[model samples]
Target: MKKFIMCFVGAMLVLSLAACTPTPVKQSESATEPMVEASTGGASDKVPDPNVEPMEIISVYSSNEDATGLNQAMDAVDELTAQSLVDKLIEYGVLEEGTEVLEFDTKDGIGTLDLSKVPSSGTSGELLMLTAIGNTFTENFELDKLKLLVDGKNYSSGHIEHGDNDYLEYNRDYKKL
Candidate 1:
């Protein structure tokens, strides 16, 4: 009876261990068999309607929840133009409402964004705003640097100011705090 009990316990332990082991999934080897494709995250991989205009996926940057650093979110825009991007930023609340992109032009590797109004946020605010805007535009426009203008004039805030030739470089060095 003692030996029988020990054997029964050992067999139960071995069966439990075998249940924990994972089996490898083998793909169908037959060429004529239809293979199931893995999901590409979500519906983003689905085919678009032929009647609808194609849209572009763009990264829209906004201040994080703490309003300290930037966080990126993907957005779809009808066009990749500067106005469209600015509209997206406004929609995300990174830029203030009523902000308009007066002009956007790229020369060489530097791009200029002229806005109707730039928020007058103080030092840290300006920093976050500029970083979010610069990172977004530089990344989307494939620009090395970006210059900002307000009402066709160089942007100047209470805590931050830009010279006649000042430009913001694509700041990808800092991680989100």
Candidate 2:
């Protein structure tokens, strides 16, 4: 009798273990295959009749964030403005007696200001060069001010032809102090 009971218990345990095991689904019998595709930025027909236009990207040379209601500050950096500014400075006699700036291309947060033509006998002009430029531009145009960069980076205060000392600096928190 003990032998019979031991055999019955062993069979029951095996059956229970088999029932607990999970069976894998046959791939051939499955109804659908998995599918995945990369998604892009595009509007679906879900929102019909949306008044939207294509996106336009442009480089901003200057903006007039502080000059609200004034559109002059948002002027795009262009050749005309650059040439005018250079001419104005020369006319203003800020370049000393013999200083001659060959080019003034300030765009995309970068500038290539060349002043190698300063006359041999003219007074050295570096201190007021950048300040005069900043003042002249800000005064005439309604812009949100500009930051000067050399070859697309912040310029250091070096000597001429280096585009040094032409950056714009501003303070964000001034009221508390």
Candidate 3:
């Protein structure tokens, strides 16, 4: 009787742990917002839009790697980076008092921007806006370059933003627009 009771208790404990484990993105709701979990760091998890999911640039046909490194890199990202971009634009006086950020970088290199999220229309130079975002991203992800696309098109501009800067120089407007 004691052995049977012990067996039941162990089974119950095992079941409880299984319950605590996070399930895969299989539910209908999760299908719309596929969560990206950071393997180690407790960073921001990106939820791709159900309307348009972002595509990944993998290692390719020959090497055949998922580029999980890139995915892992993004794990440290959070929504705050997107918010900070908006704030910086406002401080530079390029964005008006309440312009919203469409989208921008995750801790991983993937930038998730919602230009419609900008509180109001932007009031800044396109170049200024471009560099603010490009430079901000390149500063962190030194491995791959960022490709800015607005409404599914390349963020029309030139100048490949580069890292390798000695100073931690990002624009400081200090406003949360």
Give the Cα error of residue 123 in candidate 2, in Å.
14
TM-score ranking of the models? 1, 3, 2
Q: Write the per-residue lDDT of candidate 1 for residues 1-177, one digit (tens) a residue.
A: 999999999999999999999999777687687777788877887777889988999998888878768888998998899988988889988788888889999999999999999777768778878888898999999999999999998888878889987998777752453
Q: On lDDT, who's better, 1 or 2?
A: 1
Candidate ordering by lDDT (highest first): 1, 2, 3
Which pairs in model 1 have colliding backbones?
none
TM-scores, one per candidate:
0.72, 0.29, 0.30
Best by lDDT: 1
Error of 2 at 88 (Å): 1.3
Q: Which tens-of-lDDT digit does each residue in 13-32 have in candidate 3?
A: 99999999998755565476
Candidate 2 lDDT score relative to the true structure: 0.44
Top of the candidates by TM-score: 1
Better of 2 and 3 by lDDT: 2
| TM-score, cand. 3 vs. native | 0.30
Error of 1 at 64 (Å): 0.1
In candidate 3, how many clashes are counted?
12
